[model samples]
Target: MTNEFATLSDFRALLAGAALADADMFAAASEHNMQLTKPPGALGQLEDLALWYRSWRGGDNAEIAAPQVIVFAGNHGVAARGVSAFPAEVTAQMVMNFQHGGAAINQIARVNGATLDVVALDLDQPTQDFTQGPAMSENEFVAALQAGWQAVDATADLLVVGEMGIANTTSAAALACALLGGAASDWTGRGTGVDDAGLSVKTQVVAEGVALHGGQGDGLETLRRLGGRELAAMAGAMVRARCLRIPVILDGFICCAAALCLAKTQEGALDHAVAGHQSAEGGHARLLEALGKAPLLHLGLRLGEASGAALAIGVLKGAMACHASMATFAQAGVSDS
Candidate 1:
């Protein structure tokens, strides 16, 4: 029951402004954190993340609401380049696993009380329709983007975007290079554990793809040239989150590349994004740095099925609880020490 509308700047502005949480919420949460019997700043980034969530919601009372996790699953034809160790069939198999509620993300979402939805965008599905399986037209890319928005519509209060496709990391790196104006070597990272020789091959292959696309700032062109459907759908989801006023949690390196696309596509899409975790990929930190985002955790995880974001949801909930239930120093009758 999501509502779709023409692009509106006023809507985005209103949404952005609404996220500014009140000062009392912050004061209370800080006080509560201090009273937890730990010295101030003891929790480090966890406290910061809690405070950030409190501020983002405009108050401690701002309900997280019906949070939803959407795993955009697709097969990338570019895996033929040895960019990934796993076969592309893994994408479809994982999607089937997700549908059967047996994936890691599924269990994580269940624990977090988050609704999980799988959007199977068959851009490279061989049995279905088109002859051109690997590449996509601009129209198709845009359509996939819109479809992602359409899927998340009113059902999600917050969205966690994840992708499942082998070698799509190459596609993601190339897309990041195109939109963010960097070399493929700058964005490319190891996918599924390539050896030294395989890493060399991967770097060269991604560089060639970036050169083939040849764009300084054209996000759509870059996506059509090297971005997979999962990435495009991810871009669409990020944009739609801004338009719809729902915050989104991004997974790892490949998912961050999708964020890079939306950041370049729209002027302010980055403001609504939350990084779930940092990956072992070398490019992840650089990308997060470029985005001015600090991730919620760094567990050296590279499994990209929104598992990282799912883990962060627990922290986000704890943050909201502190914001809402914490008593201020004055209310607690405690002296500011």
Candidate 2:
């Protein structure tokens, strides 16, 4: 909950000492799952998801009553290179849309009964173009990360961090290629529905960025060099959630990419998080595979702003409902055999 991460080393220290889910609660939840009336493994991943959520919540009968969705917006200098279908100004404009409750995430969060907050990080001043140099200096990176860290509500039981930054997919692709050891084309995608020519341009930009700044072998350093402000904030918020033992449902490719930085940093930095959905973006599936995350939904969603994760809240809610409210075989007068 403290925003004292003044330097990248501070972040490293926090990550190194990050907490894990309550093992006792996890075991208890697992045993409780067996006592439920439903056939064993009938709910499939939902059963596992419930237990996972309970472990982090540190309660045998924990429910996601207070879920928080945060959408971080920032402008990317890389957008100047024509990496996205939309202009960089769209980032700020979309932030306004979110504030006015006109965006898809607003409706999704409201319908799911989750509180939404939008954070804009220095949109008036975009990060440096990574193809030329590091995207953000140490101070800038730390500020962005602290913005994300401070945005988390300690009272929330669940967290979902999304982004609204133009050319951010390009940034995510570059970060992925840098951290996960892949070619740019393998990680690049036509974000925001770019055409064939635009896709090629985006891919080339990713390759260029990676070739220039890749191989640092440090996740935070790679992020400072290649990630956007919103991306860094998402990483920070996820770390904050881990520290608070709040479970997280990651949004899309960009969100996963932000999480990858943390995953690559510590052994189990993302232990409290899960992929909300596999996005329609070309690189999202590969990114999820790299993170060892199986998404809860796959509705071909490419819209960010935590929309996908917000929708998947119901899925977790359903799992928690069954896990918490279901009667045991003996109580229901049902035969175990």
Candidate 3:
């Protein structure tokens, strides 16, 4: 078994002297933000997110070297409950869009020059396509975890994990309830645009699932019970990314739930995570707050295609560019009285 650094401190110590680059990158980015032709704090969260990215990179004045987004595709068995407005088949259809470059996330990825990797995990229903990617099974999940570990091992400086599955929000909510130490009622929400009655039914479905599988002790058990294969696989991937000292950007609710699982399992996994956006769903805000993370975008988007993370890539790039290009107060010949 590979040794997993369980906390941010351990990961930090592991990085040791190699982490110097991260510091230079952050300091440079901070200086550049000050020279953005505005007041120092004008950009608010954008400035902060950029600085945060710099910190993650060891502040080595590093550029956003290779930004990659992995879209974890799966199906949710719970969509049969009418919880989500779209049918479960939409998951596979959207995967097709992701592959064909027809989705919003695809456009954003293209614009940012980020490579997109799609992994299909089998936690919900199985898909019919062989050309998309590997089908996630029990063995496949572990293999994907290993593959995820290797893919994100070193070369890429930043990675974002995105998901596509109708009714995944329900799975995410249940997982949140277990991992966040809350009741199902606290995390469950109208996933797509369910009617009031549909919402009520949706909550009951999640509640029942929680009741059936609630006592698994918050890590793998929570994953085993409420997690889809993709969610489970991503949970491990998030931990591995943190262990490898790479930053992981989480897409909306589903991804946040996966992050929550990893954070609960590993003490400082949250340190490696950047919340990409808050979903319109009710529980997403609570999840972000639990992690003490603020998202980079909130376009009221509920789509689960990693689009928000893709858009935030630009903000990160800007932050990196600002750090690399901005002149210092001394360089600008501004006297320090």
Candidate 4:
């Protein structure tokens, strides 16, 4: 597993030594921006996003092509305990929905010209409820991550990770609390539109799970304690995208939690990603802050499945188009301000 997918130490090493976007290209993009007819910093973060892609690709004409979103679907053992408003069956059903392109993510991806795929991480057999015990063994966790690492297509120039698993927000909150020294009460939200009573139960489940594991494991141990398969895969996918130089636009709270885990194991892992949007989830803003990421869009979106990231894809494309095709002041025959 370590050889094929990289061990925790290897992940740490890879991330620590990973190269960032090219410095020369970044300088070039900044210079080119000043050459435009508009005054400096006119486009705000859009200018920043343009420069980021320029540096990421080490090119003056950076363009994102072959964008794809992979939604990892799994069933949480905790969901069987009524932690979610929806039943556990919805996880599997949603996986089918993603494959059939009937979900919101599909429509957004279609409009954005991004391909979508769903990876099912058959969790029932291996994952026990963390509230009862560890979610899975170390080997199982590694296998789940490897699935994500392998699922990344080489042709992909951009990636977005979305997840679907009933009660997953419970797992995400537990993992976040464990990693951030937060409380379940602060981290857990009413996922899937749960009522107050259901939210209370879910929070209790998270607290119990974290307590059972002492909330003191290394990255992998904590993941095994309270993480979901979809999350593990998302973290793995984030790591792989960094290695492959494909920038990832992350979805909502759940994906942010996975990004947190990635950073915990490999510092600066979030540097390769742009936060897609701010989810209305209670813990999402905190997660993005921890990663030092300001999302591209904010529409109170709490619906996961990479929908937020898909919406941001258009923004990214426009940023690139501006970067690559927008005329310089000289070409436009206009004086720079």
Highest-scoring model, TM-score: 2
lDDT of 4 by residue, 120-223 (tens): 99945536889778987777788778878877876888899999998889988998888887788989999899999998899899899888875466666788
**In order, what lDDT does every prediction score?**
0.71, 0.92, 0.69, 0.84
Q: What TM-score would each prediction reach against the true structure?
A: 0.82, 0.98, 0.81, 0.95
Q: Among all windows of ten consecutive residues in candidate 1, which has the lowest summed lDDT?
A: 126-135
Query: Each model's number of backbone clashes?
Result: 3, 0, 18, 0
Q: What ranking emerges by lDDT with the best candidate at the front?
A: 2, 4, 1, 3
Candidate closest to the true structure, highest lDDT: 2
- State the lDDT of candidate 2 residue by residue for 119-156, as single tens digits: 99999999999999999999999999999999999999
Q: Measured by TM-score, how close is model 2 to the native structure? A: 0.98
Candidate 4 RMSD to the real structure: 1.9
Stretches of candidate 2 exceeding 4 Å from the true structure: none
RMSD in Å for candidate 1, one decimal? 4.5
Tell me the tens digit of each residue's lDDT in model 1 across 156-191: 667898988878777777766766677667877787
Q: What is the lDDT for 211 in model 3?
A: 71
State how far residue 4 of model 4 sits from its true place (Å): 3.7
Worst 10 residues of 4 by lDDT: 1-10
